[model samples]
Target: MPSSAMPASRTDLDQQPPAAITAAGLRKSYGDKTVLDGIDLHIPAGSVFALLGPNGAGKTTAVKILSTLVSADGGTARVAGHDLAADPQSVRAAIGVTGQFSAVDGLITGEENMLLMADLHHLPRREGRRVAAELLERFDLADAATKPASTYSGGMKRRLDIAMTLVGTPSIIFLDEPTTGLDPRSRQNMWQIVRELVAGGTTVFLTTQYLEEADELADRVAVLNDGRIAAHGTAEELKRLVPGGHVRLRFTDPTAYRSAASALRDVTRHDEALALQLPSDGSQRDLRAVLDRLDAAGVEADELTVHTPDLDDVFFALTGGTTVPHQAEEASR
Candidate 1:
């Protein structure tokens, strides 16, 4: 976390391409079933990019193809400056992956798992020991380092899983539904770790079923539907794409409510609740203007609330209810 410890080369991590990851016209199929139909992705280094979709939406398929665990039937992909097909070894060397399930070997101690990952990375014995120790400490697994992974709590196991993924010092990582099944507190812990990784110049490719997770963590997000990108943008940008955004104003008395509703002719009334809803783009200027109008009319709302369409609205609007089937599949996974 030391500012001076930052790498000098990290400054260029943002502007370069093939980027940390790049996929163009990527296609995949199993037998006659098309898993990925000409998908495209571009994730800059040192940024968190969330790939969101319900089950069978090709989220895992895309992750596998990019991670070199499965070959793409068509198209091109580059990971950390290496072409996935032609130089898979190089790609393997440059990135790490934590899949949807816990890959931690239950029989082994937490420290052993970290050391195992170091060995896979082909680090020297002395260096591997150093890295394992450092990672165990960093992930707060030091106390349980000597305990079998099976003895770790759900959250502890998850921390160890991610810690193992970092043993190789990968600059780019793929986290497939990394927080799946974790409790809220554990999920938040994982989010903090992800932020720390990106802050240290590690690009994160995250796939998750939780819409709010993506909204909270991703610098940019792409919602995949039926193996194709339905939409992609920053969280706020995606939110803005959905309509029905409004501002609600509540008055203490019926008189005040009537005055405000009459002053705003186009407002929708909720007479029983003593509230009125005015259509708004959900912008600060619009809010100020609305309040100014009420003030000039000698009216004031006792309480105010802003409502904007969230990702749920965006998902339903774009893909109908197909995400339900997809989520069912993820839960199974």
Candidate 2:
């Protein structure tokens, strides 16, 4: 690797423009087994795109190919305005990757590690020190700047690793399960960092086993299954894939509950609680039809709450209740 340490000169970076990432017919294999089978992906510039799946679903393989760490057996991809294979150097220069594990060197002080990255980028000594100091402050690691990475907590080490990645100031980033082993608080901190990066015009390509993380951070999400993309959409759009979304109608009086239940044929009755669960897709049209029927029957529900299927529901329905191993791995670690 050439010195990653270099001051991004105005002329050097200013000339290059940002571009969306696109993959077509991407495929990869390991000897006898196929890992990625003709996957297609499109990640818009300045957006957070999340790739989700089970442990052996080829999420890492996709990331590796896009980040230039591993060769794809088939397919074509473009990253940061450069062809993934033809101009790999340009792609590498334009993107940063933070894998599941912390890349921080335990023996080096936090500040030194950052400065080292700056040097690797080929920044002038004064410029490298300046960038290092700025990153320490940005990541809230300034207080522990002089402390060796081994002395930092898991969260601090993770933050430092990301800060180092940002040293080169790449416009696009690949974060592979970045918060996999973090505590709730640390995970939230990382989320904030990701949001800030996107807000500042950096595009993020994230892969995680945490469905909640994808729901919370991604502008769009793609679920990979069996070496292929099973589903891709916004969180709400994906949730719509699973059934069982419904509206619960709570009546103030027994008379109203009875009337409402009779009016809606599929209404699930709960006489004791004075509530009826309707099998609704939770669409506005469905809710309107239900309300019109209630009006005709002269029945009114005191409380109406709509429940939509979440990512967990979609995951279970699509994967046959196979709990994603990544989520358990994250929780245990």
Candidate 3:
């Protein structure tokens, strides 16, 4: 990746942007169920922060509270430098929200939908038209602007939905599973849109059940489980928390394989395949150690591959095997 497109490092404390959103001990409950027990967050400006979880894990609830659409039972939060409780109007003014479901009005033309959002933000008539026109073209909706939203495909509707959200020019946006029902190609397009938003200095708070989406887009990720934060860090940091990393060595000669299997201190053997799996963190040092051991044994492997735990491994380990819903499953819903 180019340096310009690289995300700011979390460890660069001195260069950290001001907090776009901050909450401490935030709690919420609906009737007998506690949606959020006590969650704390500090998201930096111009960064993409993703909240991930299984179904009913309070990801949406967290977005709702931070966006000022719902009130928290306890704790305090500040969004866009305004207290969520004492200055909700200001918070609303500085932010935009796109929920899990499409908010596009099928009865109205796409242009009309954009105009409606412009009106909601209280832009002047002429300015509203200009903004709407510009955004329509930006999202490649110009040709379909006059058509009713209902006539558009799933991808077009999603694009229009985001275009409407940008009408207010909000510095912060809360996206609650924005790509849930999108096809793979459409999802990639949406990811590009998110990248552009952050590149232009917008802070995005995203919630999703798609682990790969979080891994791809988020500068920092927080995994929510059972109404609390299970883990929060960069994708790499979270992956390191899981312990299934290893190095695999395959040999064409059975004799070489046996020599390696005997020389290695601890290995999982695959006798039929003539392979040995050695425990490793997949670091360069670990790899070097394994190579040294192979040299000592006077054995050479035909193929060597490093295997490191990914987000799926981290998610399963952190959430106790609760699987993230796949795209097919989400589309069915």
Full candidate order by lDDT, most accurate first: 3, 2, 1
- Model 1 collision count: 1
Better of 1 and 3 by lDDT: 3
Model 3 has an lDDT value of: 0.89
Better of 1 and 2 by lDDT: 2
Candidate 1, residues 1-333, lDDT tens digits: the string is 677756755766644644789889899999999989998888888899998887899999999999999999999988998999999999988888999899999999999998899888899999999999999999999999999999998889999999999998999999999998899999999999999999898999999989888988998888888878877877766665666789999888999999898888579999999999988767799899998889888998899998887877766755675333232222111
Q: Candidate 2 or 3, higher lDDT?
A: 3
- Please give the lDDT score at residue 145 for candidate 1: 100
List model 2 lDDT by residue over 167-259, tens digit each: 999999999999988999999999999999999999999999898999999988887878877778788777766777888999879888888
Pairs that clash in candidate 1: 55-326
1 or 2, greater by TM-score = 2
Query: In TM-score terms, which candidate is top?
Result: 2
> Candidate 1: worst 10 consecutive residues by lDDT?
324-333
Tens-digit lDDT track for model 3 on 188-278? 9999999999999999999988899999999998888889888788887676566778899999999999999998978999999999998
User: Which one wins on lDDT?
Assistant: 3
True lDDT of residue 100, candidate 3: 88
All candidates: TM-score: 0.83, 0.88, 0.85
